[model samples]
Target chain A: MKKILLALSLVMIGIAYHNNVKAQSEEELVQICTMVAGDAEYLKDFRIKLDAGDPPPVQRFPVVLKKDVKYRFSVCNSKDYEGKVILQLFDNNRQLATTYIVATGKDYPYIDWVCTKTGAYHLVYSFRDGKAGLAVGLLSMVGTM
Target chain B: MIKHRVILYQALIIVLLSQVLSSCSFCSRQDVDLSQELIVPDSVIQNSTPQVSKAITDQMMQNISSPVETAALIKGLKIPFNKNFLASTKQADWFNTNFEKAFALGLYGCDLGYLNMYEKTSFVVDYISVIKRLADDIQVGQFFDFSTLKRLATNNENLDSLILISQQSFNRIDTYLSETNRSMLSAVIVTGVWVEGAYLSSRVAQISNHPKIRETIGEQKVILNFLLALLKVYDNDPSMAKLITDFEPIKKLYDQVHITYELGEPEMIEENGVVTFKQTDKQVIEMDDELYNKLITNIQELRSNLLKL
Candidate 1:
C-alpha cells in the first residue's frame, strides 16, 4: 500500500511540474507577442513550439482575412531556442508578404498586409534554415480601409 | 485482522487506479462501440471506423472574428454609444442550460468589447460581472482571470490592457474548449459573437448612413457564409438546428449583396526600416438599400430569437 501511494504521489508531482513549466513557457511567449503587437488592436495569437528532434518544414494556419482591412502579423522566437522564425502570408494564387527577404538574407519581425480579398488566407510559420524552434505569432488589426 | 486490512487497502487502490485509467482514453468502450455500430458495415465492424473530416471544424474555429475590431471600427465612425443595442446583463442568471449560457456569454463579451472601446469604464463592471457568472456556469471560468480583468476594467487608462486581456481570456477558453472536444460550445459562442456584432453594426448603420458601416455590413456576407457552413457541420444538435433556421433568412438577404475586388498596383513602402505591403486594391460592396434593410431586419429578428432561446 505504501509503495502504491508513493508511485501515485510521484506521478501527480511529475504532472504538476510539467504543467507548471508549460504554463510558464506559454506566458513568456504571450508576453513577447504583446510587446510586438504595438498600436494594433489584438485579434488572435498563435503559439508554435516545434519538436527539436524532427521539425516540419512549415506549419500552416488559416485565418479569414477581411477585405480592405490592414492587418499585422508579428512573430517572436523564444530566447531559449536557437531558431529564428520566418512568417509568411499567402493564398492559392500568390504569396502576399513574408518576414524574411530571400534575396537580402534578412528577416523583419512582422509583416504588414492590406488584405484585398475576403477569404481564407494562410499564415505559414517556419524556422529559418528549417531548425527546430519555439515561437509566438500575433495577428492584429491595424485599421479598416 | 492485519491481512483483512491489507486486503481492503489493496481493493481501494485498485478502485482508484481503475478510476484514473478509465478517465483516460480507451476506457469509453461503450461510446466507441455505439459510434462504430452506427457507421461500420456488419462485415467490417471490427476493422474499420469512419473518419470525421476536421476541415469544417477547423474553418469554423478559425473564422471566429474578434468583436473588439468591429467595436473599434464603430468607434472610428465617431458614433455615440447606445446602451439599447447591448444584451441585458439582468438575463445572466436566467440562462440555465449550457447552450444558453455559452451563447449569452458571447453576447456579453461583444457588449463588453463595445463598452471597452467606447471607454465606458463605469458600465464595464456590470458586463464583466455577468460575463464571469456565465463563464462560471459553463465551467470554463478558470481561463478568465476575473480579478485582473476587473482591475483593468475599472481604470480608464488601462483600456488597452483590458481589451487585450479580455480577448486573451476568450481565446484561452476557445482553445480549451477545442482541445477538450467541447467544440460545440465554442461554436455556439462564435455564433453568439457574430450575431451580436452584426446587430450592433446594422443598428448603427440604420441611424447614420456611414459608408464604412455599410461596407462592414456587406463584409458580413462573407463571414455569414463561413459561419453558416460551420454551424451546418453540427446541424445534428437541436440548438444548432434552430440557430441555422433562425439565420437562413439573413443568409438569403446577404446572398443578394455583391462584393467584388478591383486589383490595383500593390505598393510596398518602408517606414523606419519596417516594410508594409499596401494593396491598392479596392473592394466594392454593392448592396441595394432595400437588401441592406432586409438584412438588418432579419439580423434583429435572429438576435431576438437567440435571446429567447
Candidate 2:
C-alpha cells in the first residue's frame, strides 16, 4: 500500500510539472505588438501591417489618430521552442525607424512609434527557431493604405 | 439431482436470453430505420431523363437579356477627370461632365433593377440598345436623346404613365423573392448607397477647386434626403434596420467630413487664376471592434423581429 501511494504521488508531481511547463510556453506565445502615439501634428497615413511569411500573407489595419491610440502586434505559437523574431519598420527613405526584439512567449514583443510624415512605410518581421537556427515563419508589410 | 439440473438449465437460458437481447439493442441503436422505404428499381432508373420546362427556359432567357434593354452604354470610355485641378473653371467642366455620366449610370442601374425583377427580356434589350447609342453620342459630343430627361421632368405631371408602368413591373417580380433573397437585397441596397455616397464625396474633395462644387452641393443634399428615406423604409424592416445601423460608422465619418470641409462655400478664385488654400491634416477614423460587435448583435435582434413580419 505504501509503495502504491508513493507511485501515485510521483505521477501527480510529474503531471504538475508538465502542466507548468506547458503554461510557461503558452504565456511566451502570447507576445503582442505595441504602439506609442507621438506628436499629433507630424503624423500622417498611420497604418499597421501583420506579416506571416512566405506564401506571404499580409493583413493591414488602419491606424486611428487619437491622442491615446496604442496597439500591439503579436505572433502566436503552438510549440515549446525558443522563438527569435525581429519586428522592423522603414521610413520613405528605406531606413529603419523602429526595431524590437521579440521572443517566444513574451508579451508585446513588437512596438512602433507614430510616423510624423506623409510618405511610404514598410514593415517586416521574421521568426526563427533559436535552437535550430531555421526560419519558422516570416510576415512582412501586413498593412498599407 | 433433477432439481439442481433444472435450476442450472433455467439460469443458463436466462443468461443467454439477456445476452441476445443486449446485442439486439446494440444493433438497433440508430433512431431511424434504413430499409423501410422502397428503393428505385434498376430498370426505371436506367430509363429516366431529366426534363427542362418551357417556363423555366423562358425565365432564363428573360434574365439574360434585360440589362441590355435598358440604359445607354458609353463607348470609348475616357477616364473621368479627377477632381484634383486647382482652377475652378477646369474643375467645373470636369464635374459637369462626370455628373452627366453619373446620372446616366444611376438611371441605368434603376432600369437594370426593374428589368431583373420583372424579367422583361425584349424591353430590357431595346432599352440597353438605346443606352449604348446615347453613350456613343456622348463620347462624340453629339446629342443622342433628351427624351428620357423630358419624360422625367413631366413624370409628376403625367403620373399615370410611368408610375403605372413601374408599379406593374414591381408587382410582377416582388413576390418571387425568398426571405433570404430579400435579406440579400437589403444588404446590396445599403452597400450600394454607401459606396455611391463615398465615391461622390471623394470626387467632391478632388474637385475642391471647382466652381461647380458649390453648385453641386445640392447633390449632397439629395443624398441626405435619400438616406433619410432609406432609414424610414428600414425602420419598418428589422433586418434592414440592422444593416442601416452597421452603416452608422460611415455616417459618422461623413458627418465629420461635412463639418470639417463641406460646410464652407467655395473659395473665390483670384484674378491670376490661382486659388490659395491651406492643406490641413485630417485625423484618421478608427473602427472599434467592440462597438461594431454590439451593433451587429443589435441588428441580429432587429432581423429576428423582421422575420416575424
Candidate 3:
C-alpha cells in the first residue's frame, strides 16, 4: 500500500509540472489574440510558434465568407518574436480582397472587410521576418450591414 | 522480508513511471480500456504549426469548427433556427461517461451558439447548465465561469457581450485542457463540435438548395480528412476506434471530391499610402449531385454514431 501511494503521488507531481508550461504558453496566446480581436466580438484564435527562418511558413484558415457580411481579422505577436505578422484575405477565385501586411506600412493591426462576394475564403498569416516568433491570429464578425 | 519489500517498491516505481508518461494521453481513464496505449509523439502533432497542404492546414487551423460563426452566417442570411437540427439538452444527462460527456459537450456547444444567435434566452439556461455539468465532470469546470455566463445569457440584449463571453468561455476551456495535458478531452470535444456542426449544415443543405451551404459541406471533405488523422493519434482507445470506424466511409466519400486551383497574377494596390496585395489563386470544386447526396448521408451518419454512442 505504501509503495502504491508513492507511485500515485509521483504521477501527480509530474502532471502538475507539465501543466505549468502549457498554461504559460496559453496565457501569452490569449493576451496577444485579444489585442487583434479588439472590441469586436471574439470568435476564435490560432496560436503559431515560429521556427528560425528568414520567413516562417504562412498559416492558412479557410471559412465561407458571405457577400456584404463584415468580418474582422487581426494578429498579435509575442514580444520575443523579431517582427510583426501580416494577414491576407483571399476570395474563392484566389483574388486578394483586404490584406493587412501590404496595407500601407505593413504594420496595421487588423482588417475589417465587408465581403462583396460569397464563397470560400482563406485568411493567411506569416511572420514579417523569419526570426522565429510566436503569434496569435484572431477572427471575428462585425455583424452584417 | 525487507528485500522483498524493496523489490516490490522498484516494480511499483516502473509501473508508475509508465503511468506518468501516458497519463496526459488520458491519465485517468478508468472506464476506458487501457490495453492499447495512446501513442503520439510531440514532434508529429502539427497542432502549433501545420505545414501540410492548404486543405489539411485550413482544417487544423480551425482546431475547433466555428459553429458560432455558422450560426452568425445563418442569421445574416435571414434564416430561422431549425431547432430540429439540434441535439436536445434533455439528453445531456444521458452522456454519463467521460467519452459521452465530452462528445455531448461539443454537441451542446453547437446548440448554445445557435440559441445565442437566435436570442433564444429562455432555452440557453438548461444548455449552459448541462455544459457546466459536463465540464465539471471532466475536471475542467474551473475554466467556465458558469454564473457569469448565466447572467450574460439572462440579459437577452447584450448579444455582443454574450457572444464575447461565450467565446471566452470555450477558449478558456480549450486552453485549460491543453495546458493540463487533457488533450484527449480537447480532441473529442472538438470532434463532437465538428461532427455536430457538419451534421447541422448537411441537414440544412438538404432542406434548402442554398449554394453556399452546399459548397460548405463539399469543402468539409478537407477537414474530415484531417480530423481522421487526428483521431489516428488516439486510435488505441475503444471509443476512438469506434469513432474511426464510423468516420471511415465519410472519408471515402470526401475522397471523391476534387478541388482544382488556378493561380492568377498577384495584384498590389496603394491606397492612402497603405500597400495591399491580393492573391490571384482561384479554386474550382467539382462534385456531382450523386456525390453530394452521398456526402450528406455520410456526414449525418457520422453524427448519428456520435450521439447514439
For this target, which candidate reaches the highest lDDT against the unseen true structure?
Answer: 1
Candidate 1 accuracy as TM-score: 0.84
Model 1 chain B weakest lDDT span, ten residues long:
B40-49
- What tens-digit string does per-residue lDDT give for candidate 1 at A1-145? 5775676677666655765776687678877787787888788888765544444456566667776678888899988788888888765435678888898887888768887766656677778867777788999878876
- Per-residue alpha-carbon lDDT of model 2 for B1-309, expressed as tens digits? 667656655655665565455434223312322112111111111112113222222112111111111111100021233322111111112223322332233234344333323333434344434434433433421222334423532443332223223322322222222111332232232233233323333344343534333222222222332333334433565644664665564344333322111122212222342222111223232234343333334333332232221
What are the candidates' individual DockQ scores? 0.31, 0.01, 0.18
Candidate 1 scores a chain A TM-score of 0.85
Segments of candidate 3 deviating more than 4 angstroms:
A1-40, A46-71, A76-106, A112-137, A142-145, B1-64, B265-280
Ranking by TM-score: 1, 3, 2
Estimate, for each residue in B168-280, the C-alpha lDDT of model 1 and write its tens digit.
Answer: 88988987887678888888888888889999998998898888888888888767766666677778999889878887777777768877766566677779977898766
The DockQ value obtained for model 1 is 0.31
Best by TM-score: 1
Q: Highest DockQ among the candidates is held by which one?
A: 1
Query: What TM value does chain A in model 2 reach?
Result: 0.32
TM-score of chain A of each: 0.85, 0.32, 0.72
Candidate 1 - CAPRI tier? acceptable
Which runs of model 2 end up more than 4 angstroms from their true locations?
A: A1-17, A24-82, A88-112, A115-125, A128-145, B1-309
